[model samples]
Target: MPEHHSGRARRIPPTLAAGLISLLAVLALLVTLPGTATAGGVKRPVHPDRDWMGVTIRAHEDGAGPSAAAQLTASVEGVDVSSHNGSVSWSSLWNSGVRFAYAKATEGTSYTNPYFTQQYNGSYDRGMIRGAYHFALPDNSSGTSQANYFADHGGGWSRDGRTLPGVLDMEYNPYGDTCYDMSASELVRWIGDFVDQYRYRTGRDAVIYTSTTWWKKCTGNNGGFGSVNPLWIPRYSSSAGELPYGWDFHTIWQYTDSGPTVGDHNRFNGSLSRLQALANG
Candidate 1:
């Protein structure tokens, strides 16, 4: 969710370069985080209340980062999060009209979300359907290892509609190499291994979250994943972008990484019954 338009920053410190920008970011972080203790004696993580997470995404007429959401039709709106969102009050988010969520659970085989337990359970408590995601690092570890790590940690599945299937986030590499330097055929093989292991472990196909460009360049425009997995595409400008190489349609479209809530905004492309069917399996 944090990756949008190349200005995305996972947190505040890493992206601050200009002196004035750093000063303003400090001021912004200070202003957003406040005394957040519950009356029930529960302490919460301070939300880094960011307007645009340091990037300039001027989508709406107001010139803010997705300052306004498109008036969606025949769809169920949702949101997603990672450590980038820090601590969030999910109940408040649910009241804002999000029906489901996807939380970044693990990256590769080594990294795990420090805030996943709180966010996952919090979403369920607030009556929002939730799913866990794994940020793929095919170069870092074997696909089986990373998939197992994700599934073992918080990526498990259930029949309850409150829980969605696991998602695999394969995008432009955040580090240095975008494709992890894997050849197109190699990339395809690696992804195949991930899906195979994910289905073997969870008994459900993993959702592939990617952009059309990345799919074409990294996997040589391979459409093989379409058979075993549903597609989730991230396109900020409009909802009518070309579907990736893998599928005829996307089940979920993340229209914007900026929303009225703590994470990137998304929507189910079909009716609630179809969404429920996806969740049931």
Candidate 2:
């Protein structure tokens, strides 16, 4: 048996055997690496759990701009809530000057916020012009599928003058590669897929929620959606420093994750009536 195997093994070329050994060594090295795996030109691990908006930004780019209290300018106040926030107090937020709110509804095609009904409905019940947002997980499924799941869950919009358009939370990936293992153009296409399908489903252009750093890094600062989608920028600083390339202005600026009230605090770029007009539209 040993002689038979030796005869067969000798049939391989010396160069091919060397190449096979080298490839196995490379594979072994990758497998031994602690926290990263190669996918589509990026190195990261896949975490299928739901990650809320701004998770990556808070991890990587927090404190890059002015303090959260720097901008004393007058604007409509708001908050964005996720499952992390649990059941939010709508009346307390409203009384504390939160005129608008966004509750996380869905993530990917698999997860929906358990507290969505209470947060989304409670804000509206308290007379806040509220919207629902989907925390996008582009790596798990096609953008169209995620959009459908989001709209079907709680991310629907109505022109009742009290309901705002749904938001697409497009920040950095909480569980995987920063750009979901996609190239910049590919990420742009995914976003287009989501917004286009969302508009088809709800007849409203979805608001895009992202930070400038993640936008520039992942999308290569693509400006295609800026013409139609309102930008929701997260800064966590006093001033919303530089915006991504496509947007001239931010519709909503999420300035702080730790608000005095609850969840992330935001400021609309316009007056209360303008906010209403946005809701009506």
Task: Compare the candidates by lDDT and give the number of the best one.
Answer: 2
Error of 2 at 273 (Å): 0.5
lDDT on C-alpha atoms for all candidate structures = 0.74, 0.83
Residue range 27-122, candidate 2, lDDT tens digits: 888864533544543333333233566767788896545446446457898888888788888888878878898888888776778888999999
Residue 8, model 2: lDDT of 47
* Candidate 1 lDDT trough over 10 residues, lowest sum: 48-57
Task: Supply candidate 2's per-residue lDDT for 260.
Answer: 75
Give me the runs in candidate 2 sitting further than 4 Å from their true place: 1-50, 64-70
Native-referenced Cα lDDT, model 2:
0.83
How far does residue 92 in candidate 2 sit from its true spot (Å)?
1.3
Which residue pairs come into collision in candidate 2?
67-238, 68-238
TM-score of candidate 2 on Cα atoms, chains taken together: 0.81
